[model samples]
Target chain A: MATALNKPDRTLDQRGLLCPLPVINTNKAIQELKPGQILEVLATDPGSKPDFDAWSKSRGHKILSVSQEQGPPKVFRFFIQRSG
Target chain B: MVLATEQLQEAAKQGFKKKLVIVVSKGTIDMLYPAFVLATTAPAMGIEVDLYFTFWGLRVLTKKGVKSAKIGAVGNPGIPMPNLMGVLPGMTAMTTKMMKKRIEKYWPSVPDMIKMIKESGGRIHACSPTMGFMGVDEKDLIPEVDDIVGASTFLGWASDPEAITLFI
Candidate 1:
């Protein structure tokens, strides 16, 4: 139940997309949320880790956490908060 | 003096919003993809992007060119085939088809990328001299082109201290 408290305001699924799409879509998706809202992104692009990190830093967004699942198709989960 | 130094530090912390100016001079499929990719991606990252298409690159902005753009295997060192083999009649077409297939599997088409760039507020500038040289009329260009400008105008934009300029 503790995890339920951290539910993001919006979730963007960028699975199967490649470099730049993940970051580009994230930028578009985040604009739909209010400042301080959290966006949960599910991306399969291995490059998303660094790309998202750099994108968030440049735009003044706060990346709360990131985790990766090791699978045949590895998935990266990022919880980013839109800065006020 | 201390106040001025503190203000300068604050400005640095805030960071300057840089513009991205990409000059695209080639019309091949391989060359155009990277140029459009960066042009689209930079705007998404909150950077203002201006794409200057000149010389052969101006063809890419034409309605006909976007549909007929092909990759040349003959002179491209990246192609695995020998130069002689690459000159075979269908080699360029085959190579172009193969490259498009590989690219489409994980990426958006060039047209779609251009749309994304425009939607994200990126500007596309066509070189006026190239337009005349290539006989590309304004009606021949895709609607996405924001302006038909000259070298001096593009250079002025690229001269911004906070601008990142690239020639592709």
Candidate 2:
């Protein structure tokens, strides 16, 4: 399915979490990935769109793509490529 | 005119100061969230943050108050007229409960936010005069409070040219 399309180096399931939690958890998760490694983040917070955009810009990470997955509870998927 | 030019030259040499100072004067649940939200966000953005809690806002520094902070729906402009049922005796508590449930969906609770601020190295200060007026001792405040200080001391920090100051 979604996993087969993009093979992420790390995937973080942040579903059911809120704003800063998703952002905070994403920060911790991304730190483990090496430079140029792809980190996939699954979050439910509506604020994640702006939060991820700002996070990517501030930390110089490249956002490969952001897609809203259709689910009973819609989820936001962020593909982030860590950049030094 | 010459002084302005020299100050600009010094600023260019030293880099712009990135600091935020916010004074929280109200302790209502609705009132306190903005301060916590901005305080935490600034640190996330690599900006130094200082929070000054005074008057009614001083309650937020207290363990009991922080744990049970209530929203005042009667006078709060954010909540509409139908919600003004808050003027009733038990309404504030009801409103607080409802707000907590809703806020949990998208944001951390007040106490959690405060903890996050402390963990992120944001400075929290209790107003000395207000503490004295309320007869609250240092032991009553949360462990996160860095200091109990007077207005002058906090004003000195906020007065920095590079500091963005807000009164919430």
Candidate 3:
């Protein structure tokens, strides 16, 4: 439950991208990480949270955690673990 | 009686099938977008994708068409632009340019979406009969086209029992 303990192998900054870009980029980024490695994605797209949730379910990937960073520009962060 | 885990696994494996086929028949900016969006997303979920472009849909693969793809503003009331302005010369062109710029703010450009689809492993097919009807040659098509095939060939790809076909 506490994914904060696990350091991400890589981080993807997807701010300013919108609708489907975040999902598309996140999918590609996960490919570079080894299976079981963590990928932290920071996206400003409002759709990113639901999109990642659906993607993780369909791909069998694990979503370790999802958190929000309220900013002058708000950001949605997802911690995902690549599935084999 | 509870079945063995191995038996359950075998049954689950037998039920698994993951293939998607989309047939696009219109080339307008609005019409082409659903196909583009879906094609790019499906492959990311490990589903194999085949997109068949036919008739006017083939225009989406052309340089001029893709560069100037426009919304049909006259008859349709969906666009907020005044119907009187729709008939004016250059109005459609002006509206399309403005719309395209606005779209870029929220979505990837059409060319980038096509590139993403290819890089994600989705197949793009242009209808061969349409090419002949329009007098367009292979050289006229963009580099992303995987093949030019007739209806029969596309039917063959869509006929697989495991494939889910959608007409867009």
Q: DockQ winner among the candidates?
A: 1
Task: Write model 1 residue lDDT over B1-168, tens digit each, in one string.
Answer: 344334433444777666889999999988998888888788766678999999989888999887777899887999877878998889999999999999989888878888888988899899999999788899999999999999899889988886789999
User: Which is superior by DockQ, 2 or 3?
Assistant: 3
Sort by TM-score, best first: what order?
Answer: 1, 3, 2
> Which sections of candidate 1 miss by over 4 Å?
A1-6, B1-16
Q: Best-fitting candidate, measured by TM-score?
A: 1
**What DockQ does every candidate get?**
0.43, 0.16, 0.41
**After superposition on all CA atoms, what RMSD does each candidate show versus the true structure?**
4.5, 5.8, 4.8
Question: For residues B1-168, what per-residue lDDT tens digits would candidate 2 score against the true structure?
Answer: 344334434553577646789999998877888888778766555568899999999998898888888877787767654655767788777777888888876788788888998888888999999998899999999998999899799879988987889999
TM-score of chain B of each: 0.90, 0.87, 0.86
The models' CA-based lDDT, in order, is 0.85, 0.81, 0.80
Kindly indicate the candidate among 1 and 2 with the higher TM-score: 1
Q: Report candidate 1's fraction of native contacts.
A: 0.47
Report i-RMS for every model: 8.7, 10.1, 8.6
Pairs in steric clash, model 1:
none
What is candidate 3's lDDT per residue for A1-84, written digit by digit as tens?
Answer: 465526788999999887677887788899898998889989988778777877777666889889888885789888999988
How well does candidate 3 match the true structure, expressed as C-alpha RMSD?
4.8
